[model samples]
Target chain A: MESDRSHRASRRRFLGGVGAAVALLGSGRRAGAATPDPAITELPDWTRYLGEGVASRPYGRPSEFEAHVVRRNVAWLTASPESSVNFTPLHDLDGTITPNGLCFERHHSGVAEVDPAKHRLMVHGLVERPRVFTVADLKRFPGRANRVYFMECAANSGMEWRGAQLNGCQFTHGMVHNVMYTGVPLKAVLEACGLGPNASWLLAEGADAAAMTRSVPLAKALDDCLLAWAMNGEALRPEQGYPLRLVVPGWEGNMWIKWLRRIEVGDRPWHHREETAKYTDLMADGRARRFTFIMDAKSVVTNPSPQAPLVHKGTNLLSGLAWSGRGRVKRVDVTLDGGRNWRHARLDGPVLPLSLTRFYFPFNWNGRELLIQSRVIDETGYVQPTKQALRQVRGTSSIYHNNGIQTWHVHAGGETENVEIS
Target chain B: MSRFLSLAPALLVLVGVLALALPALGQTRGLGRPALPEEIKAWDIDLRPDGHGVPPGQGSVKEGEAIFLKQCAACHGEFGEGAGRWPVVAGRESLVNENPEKTVGSYWPHVTTVFDYVRRTMPFGNAQSLTDGEVYALTAFLLHMNDLVKEDFVLASDTIAAVALPNAGGFYDDDRETTEKHFWGTEPCMKNCKAEVTILNRARALDVTPDDKGAPKVE
Candidate 1:
């Protein structure tokens, strides 16, 4: 409601103030790329400190050299950008930290360009004391937590349900990313509202044009849900909900509403469209499956993936990422020449609960056309299966939960293409 | 020496090109100038559920009806029945699990969310253009159409705090904490995982749709 011009100016200044310490001249533009003009003298200090500043970017971003890290959409999937999804570039880097800018995106009515200044998080359901927290007030709450978790869309591997639909990891396992969240625990804030004894469920709604809404179990909300204020150590980027978003670890990403503000606790799940019409899985029994909240374990190889081609016939360090919505990835097994032989991979980085776990497979290549694949084992003992293994059970008619082993065909020329074994 | 001298111009140009190309090739860090005082004062309009940052204003159902008809009815429909694929504004309750028809009246958990949504993004094209009074009025009218409120029931910045949403009781705060039960090595058993666990027949547990619609779902 505070629409003063000064307020808008202040927002601009905050961005301008982001530590652009190592301006590095043309760093604002693409790296190693030529700047249009060469005749200009020295630039200003602010401009000199152009790129993200030191200690400023508490959470680091991908190097400018890795500009290809992005979310890509399958044009054949849907027509509109607002109604469809674009996956993250899962094959581009090492480590579990997903840069805020490179995280994958799925939109209902498109990302709502909601202004944090006008946004408000309302909690007014089955509560004894109803209260609204200003962005500052929410920050003032006592409980704060820093946790790492991988957010996988329920539809991350949806393509493999039928067959290998896409070749690149960007399209295969790109619908998910892991990041560190900084925020107040949902319980701490809910307690301030004084929940009624009957409050057993929570309906989360977004401030987007779609007004995306979903019903979450009260047990889950008070369990691990975080009203996240920061991603990867920095205030969220606008695309990732600049002010705040709901972070539900180890669950489907859709339930993690961005630009979040409302939490109404009740005794029953509000069968919103997301749970009933859209997100639900249609079973072979002609019954529309619903309440499929948890996202299962899944993994894939990023490097030596489609876009990352083999430069030569030598020893290459092949690595990929594995994660589980149930818990930590137990181990990742890699097959260099198809499943004829399987070898264990080294799982690295912070192997936190329900977060992305990076796995590496060191192999010697002899320049022959080979079939490469990786399988993940979760703490729940769930093993990611092959595309054929998956479709044999759950027919290809589902669009929701698809956790299958993905295969990449490597050629003598070192080019990888998406393929099926059986 | 003469070759180096003759190629100096081009060499300098090449160095500049590399400098332009690799922006981070040579860089040092330092905090630049301080931001102006005005920068910190923005974004103070965030509204909390416990009632903070709410502006002053009030509107009646009669005043809001016109606003709704002119601004909302086009997309929401003349009677707010939600004519097309657009979401239905009212009617829905007990329709969730079994043959459910989700609607604002039946499924929305909190009425405050209606106001929160409108104030944040509404009317599709011209979002955030409505006055606080108009927002209150439209909120009341939408509820009225859902049969939750009387035809004359009015909503205002002050009165909105009291309207309880039907779906409000359908939600809860998430709080999952410990992960040791699900993660962490049990006995550092890196070798022979097969000995520790016996494999029974593996049955398919889930079936996901790969395409859009009418595809046969088998599991």
Candidate 2:
């Protein structure tokens, strides 16, 4: 009886607070009579009507209001859609995990639609037993594991190497995505067919028309590699190599062959067109750097950026993403004055190895111009370098592996633009 | 003795269950069957720099020119100079320029890459449709266009390796750990990192970024 009395007292207090707010609104309206907010006074249509029943959409979709959140592509970036890329809308997302449908797509000859039953993964060359396994056969193998990893294209920030080119982070840094994958460890599969003594490298080939191929060291293949078929608790999307794909953790996205068809063990690397003509980092001295696999520590402020501008004047929350291919992110630093001073930003959510980490910094804005930036330090104590520092050594020619600090200039009127601070 | 006799029945049942489960676990270990030689041949198409997987075929520059015009010239241009935004396959621009034109003659290191790329994924949408001889012909024509071979040169599986291009020694293994690591100090500057900051460039000035309507803002 005493607890019920206290609850009634709290209810009365809440009602009194609402009545006082209305009375204040009435007194303020004496200057110029204003219409009351319909949203606050009248019930919305949903309150008076019955909504759709369960499973209206067999697979649930995002609310219609969120239709603008989507993958975007730069039409002039490449020649054709078949051999092009589309970026994830990073500014529209939250947390560390990128939704499966929103993951960035990089295609050589477009998405291949393969029937799982007819598709096969052939393991040959430098193996005791050359095996061909169907999709069902792979599932029966023991020691299945689920892991979250970020796959980044080597040329993620290629355009920004010279200067700030892309306005939105979606175009500048969206050639990446992180997802939880369910699959068997590659070590288990390779062990099933015993490796030959001479095996030191392996070639991963895709089943798409491009038949994309990349040679990987056997030591890495035996390490944290996976043969994944499911992502985010569902079967892989066709655009992301539906039946199966190779997951070379902590390496360039090109090494992760989609629609994986074959694995050939060898004693040396195959320098394909991707490794030679493309993906190589060209130096100012006219020499190119080959086999630069690991993506270094990098971070970017998603909010107060070009697309997502700071509108509120009193208080605001700044958020962004940071990650490293080598390991977990140890700390993230934010700068509001373009590197004059740095403050530690709170790293939120689980900081998994080779996965995206979310970070936030709360600040009170006073309607002043601000230059915003973020930097990440990985577990290995590697610090994200400044754009000038990277250019001092590597030059502006290299189109791949540009992990430099990005600066966003926020105006007093709440408009933000991508800028390079010197 | 009476207590031991009561537990014997339970122990016997446990032993029976282990015997039945052991074989099923063994079966799971060996999941896939051994692939036949024919199946390997159908998919093993990748080639190495040493010409390890080069198929036995030969094509002359004359024959290659015909195939290039009919099959590949629509996008690659009549003389492989690139049409519209397609890749220019024959030029050799300076590497240190503001915008380097890296073509087959200027950038590619291996001759086998030409053969492998064409056979595997060239003709854009109609990939792997070319016969092995036609791919060799296309490779020969590309070499001729790059001025690496004579018009009468014939590229065969055995002869392709002998042909070498410039910039073969232009690439080195990644040395960022040694060359660029010193720039990344353990303790980055927190206060007074720079005396003053000025905006050097703005993305809006270029106006090349795509608009929200998904159209190029080039105009």
Best by TM-score: 2
| N/CA/C clash count, model 1 | 47
lDDT of 2 by residue, B72-117 (tens): 8999899887775667799777788765767889999998988999
Q: Per-residue lDDT for A394 in model 2?
A: 91
Tens-digit lDDT track of model 1 for A1-422: 12234324533332232222113222443434575544355576757677655887786666676665566665435434566777787777678888777788887667767677777777766876555565666776657899998888888776555555455678767888888999988887777677899999888877676666777888888898999889888888777766889998888888999888666677776555566445665443333446767777777888887667565465789889888877888889887665666789999877877888898888888878777778888877767765665545445545667877667777676666566664
lDDT per residue for candidate 2 within A1-422, as digits (tens), equals 33335434533432343344334433543334377766668999899999999968889999998896889776666667788898888888999889999999999999999999889999999998899988788898768899999999998988787788777788788888999999998888888788999999999999998999998899999999999999998999999998999999879999999999999999898899888998888899998999898888889888867667765666899999999988999999999998999999999999999999999999988878999999999988889988999999999888899899999888876667789999
Report the C-alpha displacement of residue B60, candidate 1, in angstroms.
25
Model 1 DockQ class = incorrect
- How big is the positional error of residue B7 in model 2, measured in Å on the Cα after superposition? 14
Which predicted model would earn the best DockQ? Answer: 2
**Native-vs-model 1 lDDT?**
0.66
Candidate 2 lDDT at B132 equals 89
Interface RMSD of 1: 14.1
Fnat measured on candidate 1:
0.00
